[model samples]
Target: MTPATENPWAFFDRLYCISLRDRTDRRERARIEFSHMGIEMRVEFVLVDKDHNDPCRGIFASHLLCMKKAIDAGARQWVVFEDDVVFHRYDPHILKDAVTHLSNGSTWTLLFFGCLIKGSSKTGNPRVKRIRYQALAHAYAVNRAFGEKILSQPWCGVPYDTMLRELSDDYLGTTPFFAFQSNAKTDNEACLGLDRFRRCFGGLGLIQLMNEFFHAHRLWVILGHLAVLTGLGVCIW
Candidate 1:
């Protein structure tokens, strides 16, 4: 009675990873992770030296460059990864489920591998939920159409991930997310003028665990927060 879902990968054409030439550490980590997951991908270079400019511009340009290359290479759907990507709960079978929630014969514009996304989905498979936008972009898939749309947008010095946040439709994400960013030095801190490898609270394992739970039961977590807020309100009254 429902359209049989296909693994999100079923919809992709090719995978590409964006990496800065100097960050061999991140590239190596991603390489090992992919080898473990049986992922094959091409590497795209982020040649911009983000030190002198707003790093967001460099990020946006890097993403656009990858998209251009993918489209040029005849890939209608492309999956892009940053070197910080860390896989979780990956199974080949999770690759075969379908998550088409748009409409009859409609397709998604963007699909997140890991993100701090907002909202829920009752229509699609629970494992594949529709979402509003990405708070993070370590990993995601994009259709050529949406990729072109993104390319068309003016960077204007805004954080590229912030630009992603304004998208409210045609976005889908996996639950128990297939990947997340590891606690590695990244633009998350560099953009703030912080030094590389900033020590995160509770360390890398804690960060990964937080993403695991959030991806698995984000709605419940949101509701729990709301309940606590309401209880506090009642106590104050």
Candidate 2:
């Protein structure tokens, strides 16, 4: 039996729908969609509580805290969702199976759907097969062992991509990491909105555009745009 069959709601259990204070509707949709599917999950609003003036670090810190909470709850598997993601043609069963495949493989340090498609340069260990970029936390899952591995790693004071690169190189070297292919051909991304991050920040230069296109996995761009716009949030709810 699958994990969801045992718990019915196991896929959604301990899921944290990370969002800003202004994104109540986005949170609501994510929460309701999962609930309707008999997946027990909750939405927790997150924002900088104080005027620290550091938006980037604050967001990462909040994610770490929420992830720790899920781990503490004895969650063997957990999903992290950003506000703007909407599953148009997604089947919960298929998603569950995909996650199970990665988890059961046991060689991967992380399983995510968003990342830049790149070739792996660091080659030493035979455990890993190849390297690709763009694994975003949005709509991603981490097995129990992966959680522990991440927790044990030192927190790097950089963007999520840099941190993932470092972690993949050091820990998951040569391991196969499953990340989503973002183009229209991979999956039916009907509800997926425009790639705003590429439009906004990517215009600085070719290197910058290429870097963001492949590195951040564009999940943050989707979620960040959702938070900024109240009603424009794409949702699975």
Candidate 3:
């Protein structure tokens, strides 16, 4: 195991963390835990006002705000994380190695250090794998090129992770996640419901499928999947 003190990658210097103002306790805990693991971060509080009616919207807005801040700061590459993330068990060496591999590749746009879904063997790389559908925007890194592209676009109503998944040509995820939410147990019920829904109604759900079909240019793939699912439904009926 690599020593926590030395972060091999310079990209870590540009780390930014997003936390809600009212959730200082979670922020402090994350800060303390990350520090103990030798990871330093600049924290930005996402203050939710009356405009942000939905908590999910507030989260997405905060992420966009952080990306803009990174651009203004002249950062070429940066990492962003939510306050609920725990970094104590993260392997800095693996992250650095994966990033090094990705830096050599031209297709990758975003590198997810932590995600809800893992890529299959078809999408696997030596250091990273191309993700199909990743949820949870807990922790990720983006280059300035990708950041600018993201800022140029309007806010799509989908969740942050889904938006990234759709935009990037090759969204990479590490085999062993670099970070994890401290409050994973709290979201178990929600995850169970989502899993059930995905299995029964097809992946991404009907609304998200329609949204992706409309917004993203990759229509044939979505259409093909929908057709297959329709056939299956008809056969079952």
Per-model lDDT: 0.68, 0.48, 0.63
Q: Please give, for residues 21-47, the per-residue lDDT of candidate 3 as tens digits.
A: 666676678778667666654444445
Ranking by TM-score: 1, 3, 2
Q: For every model shown, what is its TM-score relative to the native structure?
A: 0.77, 0.56, 0.67
**lDDT rank, highest first?**
1, 3, 2
* Cα distance off (Å), candidate 2, residue 155: 4.9
Worst 10 residues of 2 by lDDT: 182-191
In the range 160-228, model 2's lDDT, one tens digit per residue, is 555665665422211223222222211113212334443344321233235434433456767777786
> Which is the better candidate, 1 or 3, if ranked by TM-score?
1
Cα RMSD (angstroms) for every candidate in the order listed: 4.7, 13.9, 8.7
TM-score of 2: 0.56
> By the TM-score metric, which is better: model 2 or model 3?
3
Tell me the deviation in Å of residue 143 in model 2: 2.2
Q: Give the range of the ten consecutive residues with the poorest summed lDDT in model 3.
A: 182-191
